[model samples]
Target chain A: MDDEQQEKQHLANDGRQMTLIDQIIRNKVFNCRYWKEDCFGLTAVTLVDKACKLDCVGATYSGTGKPVPFLCLLMKLLQINPDKEIIIEFLKSKDYKYISALAMFYIRLTSKPKEAYPTIEQFYADFRKIRIRNLDGTFAIWHMDELAEKLLSEEIIFGISLPRFQKRWILEELGQLEPRKSVLEEELQNQEQEQVQVAEQQNQEKDQEQGQEQ
Target chain B: SDDGKQKLNDEDTLDETEYALWKIRELKRIKQFNDEKNKYEIEKAEIDRRRNLTDMQRIQEDFKLGSDKTKMEDKTKYV
Candidate 1:
């Protein structure tokens, strides 16, 4: 809730129509300290232009495992709705493997197997050298060539689960990933539903008694 | 002094009106706060529903490839 965050909140409150992903990025990305850099002062307005200039060098937020700003850029790309060929062109590039991986993540999530798989297939060899995160909790680099192969093959790999990668975290944070709800949540939902039912039944019973009296 | 007295006389009737205006303003403030609190709670609950991690845990389930939560739960118990 600093001044910059407040500004983004104002921008969001301005009643501009955005896609769900844009809204998600708008709310969450500025909170990460990664974009707090002198160069990367971001808003929904400048988010796309600044993100296009992003490189792998000095792109990470060291205090946490999540790279919130960079992922916000990736989400911006997805929100823009470019052609499949344009994204395929991105995957073929040699530089900015982190952004490339994000493109891959987006494709794998959004596209059909018939479309996404073949496009990602040839790039597996190229992506082999791209390291995203390690096997442990730390953000120390792990070569993500295997991850690319799995994604191309449509396998789920565990990510570091940080507040960085604001899209994934927000998706998981918003409980859109129905597969991951904890047991406690299910229990609470059930309990609340039952309580509502019981309250409704009691109201009906009271109404019946009042009718009989009348 | 006559003008000042006239102003004071003008102000004397305004206090009752002022009291009602202040009450309306306070009511609006309370309604605004309640609305914001309700919105905050709903948004927070939505986030909580989607979150898989707690502040104390570091290990995460690899929820990729349509894996079962029970099996992932067994594996992620380390964190």
Candidate 2:
């Protein structure tokens, strides 16, 4: 119960606990019903319960510009400033895509370039279909992989500005990061090798026919 | 027609700010990509131009690429 009095500090980004969400929207989130009711008294440890229950990922809706439960939970996670281990656990959660999505959003907001890229990049393999709540408050199907790629490549998503990170290629060129090998690279290489063998066999057959003609 | 235009304008001004931000970031990312690629191409051309340079000149050229002095020294050993 002592941890429940949790300081009302904002999320830290780039060495400052600044409002990562726009001030107007953050205020709207605070005033939203979901934020007041469900988001109350959530500590870093207890936030997972709410995170697991999230069904859709979105920021604010269009007409009224109302914050969704997903965004409210996101704000709560930001407020609590959970440990790296806890956030990693959320990212690793197998049963809930929303938990992982929430973690990705958290990472994109709080982490430095060195930490954020690899943390989100690994999830590019998660192709499970997930729902994204559009600005119009409509749910649309989005793949887990697309979200990961967007987190890495796009500077903004769901109406939040992700802290800029050095591009992966630049890091690789500077010898600071390794080139990412795609999961499909091995299969593509095998297909090319098989094609080469078939072409070589065809060439041999053509040569044998020419020799017999001579 | 004016009333319809007014409603359309209001709608665009509402949640379209986020979309506008996305578009700006997308354009900026594309520009950065082009700049990085062009820089790479230019560096490759320089390396190719110095294909017949002596070992000492090659080391100097690598240093001019603005990498760390320590890394340049280490690379000099292998060159």
Candidate 3:
């Protein structure tokens, strides 16, 4: 065999050795009481299991669906833990678009319909503002980042901690739509006022009956 | 004969009242069910719409990136 061919074979063997070393290190790092094997990886499995435990502990006093949002929020919050290198490694393998979509789904799913729906619209609007370089040498708009950031941030409904850039983007998006938010608040206030009026009328009738009896 | 006729008329009135009440309750139950079904249908449609939009967006991006290569080659040849 040629000298070059022998060298190549030796390099390939070294590469295989390094891979084995990496696997051994990973196994040692993850084979702990807190770390559990999951579909995605050890860290994701551990986080989900921990979240499920928290869910069970809190479920005794509340209804089922109500705790889902909080659990989801907690999962996102857990991602921000400084020791989550494994989780971060798994997330890095995901495409940005896919990651953003999943984040948006999580955010929306965990949020209240009344609050989350408007935020969803806002996310779409922000997505419309993303400029991409089109093939025709023209700029086109995309909203994937904006949507992702909005989902990541804790500002809209569930106060979940996201990465810094995502939080900033969400804040900027929310700032742009402050007027619409105020209008929604005003409408909610008006509805509450009407409810109070109806309740007062019923109370007044009861008071009048008691006065007549006396 | 007059007393029997009156008794028959009273019995018919009672039957009509019972039938009307039962019909009203049935209609209400049907309406409630329809409302709940419509809500689920609306939610399903919204989810479908979002999925379609996402798919179209991805396709549009792929088309833009893919077709641009041919256009670039054409420009290079013309130049």
List TM-score per model, in order.
Answer: 0.35, 0.70, 0.20
Kept native contacts, as fractions per model, are: 0.00, 0.00, 0.00
lDDT of 3 by residue, A86-163 (tens): 433433432232332333444354344444444444333222122222222233333443444345434432222322
Alpha carbon RMSD to native, model 2:
11.8
Model 3 interface RMSD, one decimal? 34.4
The numbered model that scores best in TM-score is 2
Q: Which docking category, incorrect, acceptable, medium or high, applies to candidate 1?
A: incorrect
DockQ of each: 0.01, 0.03, 0.01
Candidate 3, after superposition: displacement of residue B63 in Å? 68
Sliding window of 10 residues with minimal summed lDDT for model 2 chain B: B5-14
For residues A1-214, write the lDDT of model 2, one tens digit per residue.
Answer: 2222232322223323337777777788878888888888888777878877776778988787889788888877777677789989889988887899999888888887777878887775555657677777666666666788788888888777777888777777788776665555586689999999999999999999999999
lDDT of 2 at A177: 70
TM-scores of chain A across candidates:
0.44, 0.89, 0.24
What local lDDT does model 3 show for residue A101? 38
Mark the regions of model 2 whose C-alpha exceeds 4 Å error after superposition.
A1-15, B1-79
Which candidate, 2 or 3, has the higher DockQ? Answer: 2
Best by lDDT: 2
